[model samples]
Target: MKKIIFIICPFIGLYWLMSSCEDFLEVEAPNHIITSEVVFNNDETAIGALNGIYNQLYTSAFSSGWQDSVTALAGLSSDILEVIRSTNITLKEYDQNEINPNNTRNFNIWSSGYNIIYMTNSLLEGLANSNNVTDETRNRLEGEAKFIRAFTYFNLVNLYDDIPLLTSKDYRSNALAARNSSEEVYELIIRDLENSINLLGESYLDGERTRINNYTSMALLARVYLYRENWGYAESLSEKVIAQSGIYELLENLDEVFLANSKEAIWQISPAGRGTITSHTNEGSIFIINPIFASLSHFKLSTGFVNSFQEEDKRFQDWIRFHSGLSVYYPYKYKIRNSTESITEYSMVLRLAEQYLIRAEARVMQDNLIGAIDDIDKIRSRAGLELLAETNPGISKEALRETIMEERKRELFTEWGHRWMDLKRTGRAAELLGANNSLWQDTDILYPIPEEERMKNPNLTQNAGY
Candidate 1:
């Protein structure tokens, strides 16, 4: 009964998707819905409004969904992926359903990501209406809200370039919203993130383990810099995050990183108490855990990647998927899927491992090989592998760069749709994926605009090649 009210109260069952008031779409009415009394009419209510945004972390948009990561099941389905998988290079298992989508052709991730934007706008609108919020408090809340907006938009523009830019509240109908250029979107992202740097507080608490604070903000900025190819800023911000007096550490065993520990969690989205959705399948699991891809032994570890790890490395144990007495290097970072019954585990969004990675990459770009090696060595030490000497590595710089990136793929595989995105960003997707020229087309990089959005707005245009 309560759930029904919660759902219905937020919707007239109509997301008008219009320009006037449709820029934002939040499912929940602010506390003032029943009465014009502002929820932020007081300090407690204002705090709750802030917390509401944090709670969005557990939503299906960021949690267990095909868009989230289950698309790992599609490797076998794509002809392009098969070539890589047959060798130790690919471990795809969910090919049959990888490109599948709803009748609308939009994965739940499409809607979920937009919903986050809507909810964020709702919070921002609420803050604007509140009189009791002090300027100091208001700025902090505003900073965090903008951070989320930028973060969400970063994924949106990256996944669907030319996405509509909505900075206001007016979404109630299917209004026409022209797709903004990818470059423009990236500019706004950098601007928003930079503004957030000074606004968000130094500490925010949510029960115990996970919450966003100054460190989380810094970590996010580092990533944005790297994404924008700003090596100096990326390196500087990463160092600031690391020098925060050891706020995070690498988990002792590589396999244990996915088990919900927070010792080195710079920022993580916990999966406790999240709702369930039907999982879309993947290539590795279907091959190793299901019978559909039985013809080929489950995809084996790639030689390039395998040679990178030392025999003593602890993460190797986590990477190997043992089935029917055969052990292959599979994606070992996601541990919440073992249960056949429910998708009930926390999915980490940010961590110290990535911070170290960004720093290493930036250092290498800066020709600071010693610094880069030190960062990589710290990561290697945590994985129980022999650290590289600071003085000289036999490998060339390009090879070393590849080594650092591959480590990220190995360590963070199957989380946040990273495998696909990382490959695309690194320009390695074409070489790695099967023989399809379509894989490299700009249109395929971003999912096509939901057809309905195009139909509603006269100004809207389909991405080239869609």
Candidate 2:
């Protein structure tokens, strides 16, 4: 894999040049290969610049939903997944919680995250300086850019504990920047999401769910608030998203939940962004173990994770598949392993089911046991399981909280780092993982800042365990 540059001048425009060599998109800006003046001069180029960010996301290591992405790496770090190949030492490090700061995958996650941040910062800067761009276009672009930045930082802070928060395109300052406290990062995340909500409209731009909208920001913000322990705000924000009944709903068929533009998706990344004729998502191609390519499969669900789900659970029946030849269970949420046809599935980022879980957890924190049960029941009902309201109506707060956490693990296994982050946020990681694995340590909660990053910036500090 290429070592992605952290600060590339005119990142988005360069992407535009690579994807579609439109001569009009070229601009004569010295020092910077592309400039805000030309890129944001009008709506067409400005939108293209934004699209560049979306397109690049499909290839970015941290967000790509591929083998090296957070979905795989973090899933390995948790108990939900195990690396199938012992020869793959890097992935095994993550699975065993013995990751080294010098690990290339760690570096890729760090660099790729900052690469996207640089694109967002550049977009925001370009929109701020352009006067010719329509107010509508400027506002929407700014909101989306900020949301992306916030989203990136949110993941960075959670993964590495303290990360440099770069909100501008100035490479000099960014190169020497020190890490910001997680609290400071969360403050910016909250502010950016708030601004995104105000600037973005309710409808998905151009009818594509891949584009950020007000509800998308709300869904992410709801998660942020839940992590920050702002229970009331988290509850209200998730409720706002869940209340959009016409636009979003829990799909009765578990198979339809991951399809492109599904009503359940709050935000999705289209594989079309990859600029390739191959339309299947990286998640599908890497995770599904086709018999002919079974030897190439790098990951499989852990035995404990597979056993955690009841035999009758619809999620187990629909979202997971067993390979009789290899005797392994793999994530089947994404059905297409390889395809040349038009895209059918997308890499899901934020979805409606998570909002219900967020709301349910938030309500549990606020002493709204009944309301929390109601929200949890929404997910259970869709899963073809007996509703909590009917099965255990008088459950206590402590037990209900545990139940919600279990539900989250069952419902959101391989999507993102939800299981890993959930264990950390709830302070259950050490207790749970330590009992099962002798190698588990309290300091393993946060991944180390990449050694390459520390070398680049002498001012940067390493996390304690590293």
Candidate 1 per-residue lDDT over residues 128-189, each given as its tens digit: 88788788878877787788888788777766667877776555432445777888887877
Off by over 4 Å in 2: 1-32
Cα lDDT tens digits, model 2, 1-466, are 1222222333443352221111111222235455679777788888878888888888888899987799999999888999888899999999989899999899888878888887888889888898989999889988998999999898889999888888887766777788898888999999999999999999997788999899999999999999999999999999999999989999999999999999999999999888789999999988899669687789999999999988878999999999887889999999999998989999999999999999999999999999999999988888888988988999999999999999999999998889999999999999887788898889999999888777657888999877
TM-score of each: 0.76, 0.94
lDDT of 2: 0.87
